[model samples]
Target: MSPGGKSAKSSSPSPPANYSAAGEEFIGVDDFNEDAHTPESKTGSAYLEIHSRQNNAILKKNQEESIETINYLEIQSFELLNT
Candidate 1:
């Protein structure tokens, strides 16, 4: 109830067209418009940049893990030789 004695309308927040809440995008089947080009290009570039960063991070973590494994294996080899 509002102060003016009117019922307030309820609305759910929604993502804009072509985008999902999980950060995925969908391409429309309609014909493309010139005005839509710039925004779409920018959105695609931004999405690519984000994905590239995520991939780089994963690669870095994997490299670190590999280095740790190699160091552990080297230590084990040295211990085995001493025994």
Candidate 2:
């Protein structure tokens, strides 16, 4: 083996960035709506920003779970070989 060690032969495909948890795609609008007066009625980019944050949160959770699962499997494999 080289000093850098061996790299894996297979890699998992990355999740799509545009997809949401509920499979909803964001369609943004061009208008900022200056005459709306109040902020509650006119949501120019809030929805998109919130949805993007939600997607990021879910992805972080999944990544954490994947690490835990990988560690568990490695321990089980070692036990099996020892037995």
- Give lDDT per model, in order: 0.68, 0.60
Residue-level lDDT of model 1, residues 1-83, one tens digit each, is 98899998768666555555554665641322323432346556566678789999999999999999999999999999999
Residue pairs clashing in model 1 are: none
The digit string of per-residue lDDT tens for model 2 on 1-83 reads 44579765546553334333355543432333333322233564565567779999999999999999999999999999999
Q: How accurate is candidate 2 locally (lDDT)?
A: 0.60
Which pairs clash in the backbone of model 2? Answer: none
How close is every model to the real structure, measured as TM-score? 0.53, 0.48
Q: Which stretches of candidate 2 lie over 4 Å from their true place?
A: 1-44
lDDT of 1 at 3: 84
TM-score of structure candidate 2: 0.48
